[model samples]
Target: MYRSLLLGLAGNSAAEALALRYGMRLGASRFVAGTTLGEALAAVKALNGKGIAVTLDHLGEGIRHLDEADGYMGAYLSLLQAMNREAVNGNVSLKPTQMGLALDPVSALDRIRAIVREAELHSLFVRLDMENSPYTTATIELVRQLHREGFSRVGTVIQAYLYRSAVDVKRLTVERINLRLVKGAYKESSSIAFAKRDDVDSNFKRLIKIRLDSGVYTGIATHDETIIDWTRSYAHRRSIPRSAYEFQMLYGIRTPLQESLAREGYTVRCYVPYGERWYPYFVRRLAERPANAAFVLRNMGRRE
Candidate 1:
């Protein structure tokens, strides 16, 4: 119930306004690097210093206008340039909607293509983030189109909670597209998603195994120690090299665990997000773990 409530608030514009006014003082700073690209780059540098890679996200989505989407594309292009100039060991992730997929699919594709082209020039990878169920098909299609157009440096995420992910994973694997396997954070319907945590975790493990066995590089994005342990054991038993996959975790969620995995000589990447439109991303982070809400509330009175 708590998780659902937070997810619901993720789209509440009035609540978002309040959050913007308060900025990171409401404890969003723990999750969001900052509201600027420079801050995000610094965070990336710090993570790189710790032997951890990063995938930076300029957090904005649910655009109502094409102009907004263009602005987002501009920001991404700038982000790509900055990442290259700074020589940071990181890539980029973006939501399809943020590029106008919902408002105008064609224009959205062009915008995303531009960003991907820019990223390719820097030899950086771009992970098209999977949104809710409504946009899942379109997001995957966009990725397919990009790959066909020679944007081989691009990839997309897969949510294990979804019933269709297995098929999507197999097909994308056959295409040799890299993927970041996540348990998903959206409030999806039971008809199309696994509602029970056990079911989701079980499916997550299944998907991880499928990708690992395919001998394709995968990003196992999760914070569950159990799942992490299972992945480690399975990979070891299968004789999969550490280079075959990397463990991905959200920023500020499990610092010690991320570093521990890195210290163990395993590749670990942090999903570091920034930008002014952080309320939605912040709420989703809270929804993923209600304990995070409690922590945020407890620290709400404190100043950044």
Candidate 2:
């Protein structure tokens, strides 16, 4: 049922209907910055003013077809150019399939190389976001190739909930890859992933300690207060300097926690996504928190 909601939002017309029906403002708050490049940049400026860094993500996944994938790659190249001209205090994140991975491996990797070269020219970073487990190996392969090409500015994500991520973390150290650790948001098989929340949290801290000790640039991406507290205690116990790593969170999800981390002098980056294609993104947020869905429903009547 939740997957259906996400798929529905990915459809442009369905997303429009849902947005209007829900009385949502739909101006790139959590889902995206905006459809226009100017709007996206303006949104970035606003966040930078608050001392919160941003990451530009062209909202998309699952290519329409090979031709469409090509078009998407062209658009990303243009976005990279704009990012260079804008020179904003943020980097770009991309999903491989969106760059043509689904069409063909060679096609996707080449396009990714183009984007990475663009980021390199501008001295920017590119974050390869991890999707479902099916794409994990392919994504890692692409990252490995890219890193071999000397793109330290490139990084990929891992889900701690995956029973195998502990080994993956060590593998990442082989390339000295920067990683964003998240509780696997996608539902997967218990054979491959931990369904219980406690187990996921435990693995998260364990991986955090190892990564910090390994001296890799790690991103602890979660809003769980307990994990945040544990991270603090662990860092303090090891007397690890604050520059060792940073905490990352989704925008519009944990305002208070983000601020608290910043006030304590920790580097906190808010994942700010912006684009007209925000429906799939918003639906995922709602599914993550049914209470948020209920809140939106309560305001439905006001929009009517």
Candidate 3:
């Protein structure tokens, strides 16, 4: 129930406004790097210093106008340029809706294409983050379009909680498109997603095995230690080299675990998010784990 409440608040505009007014003082700073690209880059540098890679996310979505999409496109272009100029060991991640997918799919595709083109020039990978069920098909199709147009440096995420992910994973792997497998953070209907944690974890393991066996590079994005251990054991049993896959985790959720994996000579990447539109992302992070919400409430009385 607590998780559902936080997920519900993720789409509440009034709650978003109140959270924005309070800014990072409400404890969003723990998850969100900051509201600017510069801050995000700095965080990336720090993570890189620790032998961990990063995927920078400029947090904004559900735009109400095409102009906002243009602005986001420009910001992403600038972000790509900055990462290259700074020589950071990181790539970029973006939501399809943030590029106007919700308003017009065609326009959103053009915007995303431009960003992918820019990224290709820098030899950087761009990840199309999967939002909710409503946009899943469109997001995957957009990646397909980009791939067909010769933008091979692009890929999209897959949510294990979804029933359709197994098919999506197989097809995309056959296409040789790199993927980041996440357990999923958004609240999805039980009809389309696995409601029980055990089921989700089981499916997550199944998807991981599928990708690992395919011999294609995959990003196993999860914070579960048990899953991590299982992945290590399975990969060892299969003799899959560490270079074939990387472990991914959120920026603030599990610092020690991330660094520990890195120390073990395994590739670890952190999904670092920034930008002013952080309320939604922040709420989703809380929804993923009750401990996160408790941390926020415990610190709500403290000054930032």
How do these models rank on lDDT, best leading?
Answer: 3, 1, 2
Report the C-alpha lDDT of model 1 over 181-240, residue by residue, as the tens digit.
999999999999999989999999989999999998999999999999999999999999
Please identify model 3 stretches exceeding 4 Å from their true place.
Answer: none
Alpha-carbon TM-score of each model against the true structure: 0.98, 0.91, 0.98
Taking all chains together, the TM-score of candidate 3 against the true structure is 0.98
List per-prediction Cα lDDT, in the order shown.
0.94, 0.80, 0.94
Residue 72 CA displacement from its true place in model 1, Å:
0.8
What residue pairs clash in candidate 2, if any at all?
A: 32-273, 32-274, 33-274
Q: Mind giving the per-residue lDDT tens digits that candidate 2 earns over 50-143?
A: 7777788887777768787677678778878897787688888888988878779898998889889888888888999998798998998899
Q: State the lDDT at 236 in candidate 3.
A: 99
Give the clash count for each candidate.
Answer: 0, 3, 0
Write down the TM-score for model 2.
0.91
- Cα RMSD (Å) per model? 1.1, 2.6, 1.0
**Model 2 off-target regions past 4 Å?**
1-30
